[model samples]
Target: MDWNRTKSIFIVVFLILNIFLYSLYVNRYNEAQSVEVAGEKTIDARLKEDNITYGVLPNSVESATYISGKVHTFTAADFTDPNHQANITDPKEARVILLSPVKLRNVNDDASFTEFVQANIKEGGSYGLWKVNRDERIAIFFQKTNNRMLYYNKSGLLKIQWNADNEVTMYEQTMLDNIEEVEQQESALPPIQVIQALYAKGLLKPDSRIEHMQLGYSTLVYLTQTQVLLPTWEVRVKLSDGEIEEYFVDAVEGKIIEIQEEKQEVEEEDWGV
Candidate 1:
């Protein structure tokens, strides 16, 4: 029997299998990385198309810096904490408030935002859109977390600003006469219900995946925005005559902010996904 030769063959085969497995792992890793980069590029393209001027999305402010002019750069680093608010230190003048003082990020879902809005604040239907009264800017950000809603904002700073305002200070204090009154409460609207309403109204596409959404409004001025990543713009419907509209619409106000067609990428390959 050729036992020594058999053992040598087995070792060679084992080494080859290990090499094959390592190659597979490397290939898979590269594929996942590519997908993430593509997703980020898609997001950046959308932002540019919408005319939203933002420096690179900063993971941390450590890499962030204020360049000359009105431009700022946000580097890729995680934020110190959700508590970190956008600095308004360079008050040679009041900042143009390009993005607003409120920083919205890491939103898990829409309901968390609506609920937070419904609580701490009061929502009275006004001119068809849901209105909440507050003097300072309130920012809301959205991100998918475990398939649930997540919200990020400078709530603490907002509260401070509201308290400083003499006009709404009294009103807010009256509303918070008791500690329990001011405590955080979940939204009365369920996550599914809120999503369903947007869907039924055709404001949100059935297949749209909301990555980052923001809401900014101050009683002194009228500015409201909601941004979401959608698969198509064919979902928006006109409330005037129940006609199907697509893409951008002021779902909250029943108005159109702007409607821009999705940009298609040109590919050289005739048959490609």
Candidate 2:
């Protein structure tokens, strides 16, 4: 006899329960949004407290994929100069000594040096000027693929040595063969996220300045013949003491890449020609 009234009561109770659950969900969503906002503001505040300054952060999101290539083997036909001496014994490299040191129009100008490389070296157009060591009398260039430089890759590098007279006396070169993307494209972490990751890891010091941020590739794996590369964000920082430091962050995975200085040194010594 009271079944109808009991059913009405149950419906009302269930309706009230749904309303309460909806309220809880709405509150949780708002709280999550607030936390995200606070987290971003905290990053800026922390940097400021540490006296760390940075230029404009990159706003655009980018996508990239892993790349792989075999080290190119140089041949005698690659070097045709009769007077200059070329050492292609390594097969993967070419070390050339100019019979006459090529004088630059402007020793201090990068374009002048780049011009010489483009004209004389094989596949030279693919290399970009990286840096010059005055004391060592050498200029280094890193190879580029798809307009992004492969950072400190020995397989795709050009090392030019100059004399006291500022003449390009000799150069060594290596290149990647069949360079191509190897994986599905993935979205790269935004520049700000990468910077925050470095700061969180204590890689960025107090009272420092983030001088520059660039996109590039770094060695992920070195095999017998092929090298695997990962897209990375290169962050350059200026410490409070005025010294510059560089760090690479895995763009897709957000991991800090520890560059192996010892490995690079061994490579240089092993292929010293």
Candidate 3:
């Protein structure tokens, strides 16, 4: 065997592997820090100026709000008592407002989150959940509200992390609340009524791999349909023991909308290059 030739090939392969790993590392790192919107680059930066920390991000407002073509705003608020008469050793309070790169409406608490999630499910869009504390939780559905972003957690119970394409992720508590709503609603609908509805619509076709369907804001079910594979436009349906269930139906038009699939379909583009 040619020892030198074998050694050279191993070195080349090792270098290529390292380069591939490095590229992946760089791409994931970039996605974690920045979100791209409307052909603009936006990043979250924390700066201490004059002993105050401010979060720097691109100006999302329409009116050319940045003085130097960039915007620096307060991300968290100070809770120092303005009425204090003397300096004390108590821990200073902090009020943090989570921001989304996508413009979203602010919901005050968990109840509002539930309402918003229900509305979005009815309208056919994706929803996110927020957990302010261990027991405090909220769910937000996209496209149901006018604002594309949502901010919550003044007391630090919620944390918002934005990905490269304005995708928002929250803790498990929030996801559970959102999923639970759909399950509960479907349980209340009569099974015989559900099967009859499918039969009337000519949806119970043989040899079809029926997936789950989404109903108005609260229920998702599986059903037998003529179409073996579900298109993105169809409501999520599932069929089990001849019972049909629906999820994420458009309240107005009865159209199915898959918000998560839509977000994942965006093409990867060079950012900050």
TM-scores vs. true structure, each candidate: 0.27, 0.84, 0.19
lDDT of 1 by residue, 20-44 (tens): 9999999999999999678656644
Best prediction by lDDT? 2
Expressed as tens digits, the lDDT of each residue in 1-273 for candidate 2 is 799999999999999999999999999999999997898789989999999989987664579899999999888888887756888878987888899888876777889779988887778899998887677777888899988889888888888888888888889888998999999999999887898899889988999999989888999998879999999898899999999998999999999998777236423623355
- For candidate 2, the per-residue lDDT at 264 reads 68
Write one digit per residue (lDDT tens) for candidate 3, span 1-273. 999999999999999999999999999888865543311211111111112111232222211100000111211122132321221122221122223223224434445444433432222233434232222322323221122211121111122323334333221111111111111111222222332344335554442323533222221222221101111112323343455433332332334334444233211121110
Best by TM-score: 2
lDDT of each: 0.28, 0.86, 0.29
The total of clashing pairs for model 2 equals: 0
- For model 3, state the Cα shift of residue 156 in Å: 23
Better of 2 and 3 by lDDT: 2
Please report the TM-score between candidate 3 and the true structure.
0.19
Please give the distance, in angstroms, between residue 76's alpha carbon in candidate 1 and its true position after superposition: 48
Report how far residue 148 has shifted in candidate 2, in Å. 0.8
